[model samples]
Target: MPKMKTKSSAKKRFKVSATGKVIGSQAGKQHGMIKRSNKFLRNARGTTALSAPDAKIIKGFMPYDR
Candidate 1:
């Protein structure tokens, strides 16, 4: 059988947590850093678990991750 390809974008952007949840980095940190407040930058610094509905879809793209 042909290999099932994972979504390249999802592979790069999301992580599968120990609890089997999908996590992703907060957006808005990619640009305009100077205008962003310290609190906003700090809060956006880490990965966050995606909501259940979103995580379900992401898991479909990352078949091997599970």
Candidate 2:
């Protein structure tokens, strides 16, 4: 059988932790930061785990992970 490839876009944007959680960057951090409040900027600085439904979908794209 042929190897299933990981989705290139998913690989770049998401991370799977050792415990099987999906970790990703917060939104609104990509551009136009000047208009955002300090709190928004502070809150957008870390990775967050995906919800169960979201994780399930992402799992398909990340073939090597659960």
Candidate 3:
């Protein structure tokens, strides 16, 4: 059987943590930010874990992570 390939886009956007959680950056921080609130900007500064269902889907693409 052929090897299953990882999804390039998913690989770039998502990361599998040491404990097997999928961590990802918050959106809306990539574009213009001057109009956004200070609190909004601050909150978007770190990675957040994906939900259970989304994490399952992300794990498929990050097979090497586990």
Candidate 4:
């Protein structure tokens, strides 16, 4: 069979963790941070693990990552 192509967008946006979880940057922080609460900004400061359902979908896009 031919090689499977990884989704370029997924490769750029998400990463497969060592334990097989999908790690991605938190959403809603790309713009308008001035309107957001300090707590919200603090909480969203780092990468987050994608939820199970969401990770499943991302995994499909990155078949070779796992």
Candidate 5:
């Protein structure tokens, strides 16, 4: 059988944590910073874990991540 390939886009955007959770970056921080409060920007820093239902779908795209 041929080897299953991981989705390049998913690989770049999502990460599999040590505990098997799918990690992803926060949204709404890419642009329009002028209107956003300073506290919102400060709190948005760093990645966050995806919900189980959502992560399960994303995980399908990462075939070789295991």
Candidate 6:
């Protein structure tokens, strides 16, 4: 059988955690930081685990990741 291909965009944007959760960078930090509050900026740092529904979809894209 032919190998199933991973989605290129998904590979770049998301990662699977050791416990099988989807890990991704926090959103809304790419631009216009001057208008964003300090608390928002502080909280947005680093990666976050995606919700169950969202992680299920991401897992579909990365079949071999788990």
Point out the worst 10-residue segment of candidate 6 by lDDT: 14-23
Model 3 lDDT vs. the true structure? 0.88
Q: Clashes in model 2: which pairs?
A: none
Q: Compute each candidate's TM-score over C-alphas.
A: 0.81, 0.85, 0.80, 0.96, 0.88, 0.93
Q: Runs in model 6 with CA error above 4 Å?
A: none
Looking at model 2, how many pairs of residues clash?
0
**lDDT, residue 36, candidate 1:** 95
> Can you write out model 5's per-residue Cα lDDT over 1-66, one digit (the tens) per residue?
998888889999999998999999988898999999999999889999999999999889998665
Better of 1 and 4 by TM-score: 4
lDDT of each: 0.93, 0.91, 0.88, 0.97, 0.91, 0.96
Model 5 sits at a Cα RMSD from the real structure of: 1.1
Per-residue lDDT tens digits for candidate 4, residues 3-53, read 999999999999999999999999999899999999999999889999999
- Judged by whole-model lDDT over C-alpha atoms, candidate 4 comes out at 0.97
Q: Tell me the spans in candidate 2 whose CA falls farther than 4 Å from its real position.
A: none
After superposing candidate 5, which stretches have Cα over 4 Å from the reference?
A: none
* Candidate with the larger TM-score of 2 and 4: 4
Top model number, lDDT: 4
Winner by TM-score between candidate 4 and candidate 3: 4
Write one digit per residue (lDDT tens) for candidate 2, span 33-63: 9999999999888889989999889999999
> By TM-score, is 5 or 6 better?
6
lDDT of 2: 0.91
lDDT of candidate 6 over 11-49, digit per residue (tens): 999999889989999999999999999999999999999
Candidate 3: tens digits of C-alpha lDDT, residues 1-66: 777788899999998888989999988998889899999999889899989998999899867777
Report backbone clashes per prediction. 0, 0, 0, 0, 0, 0
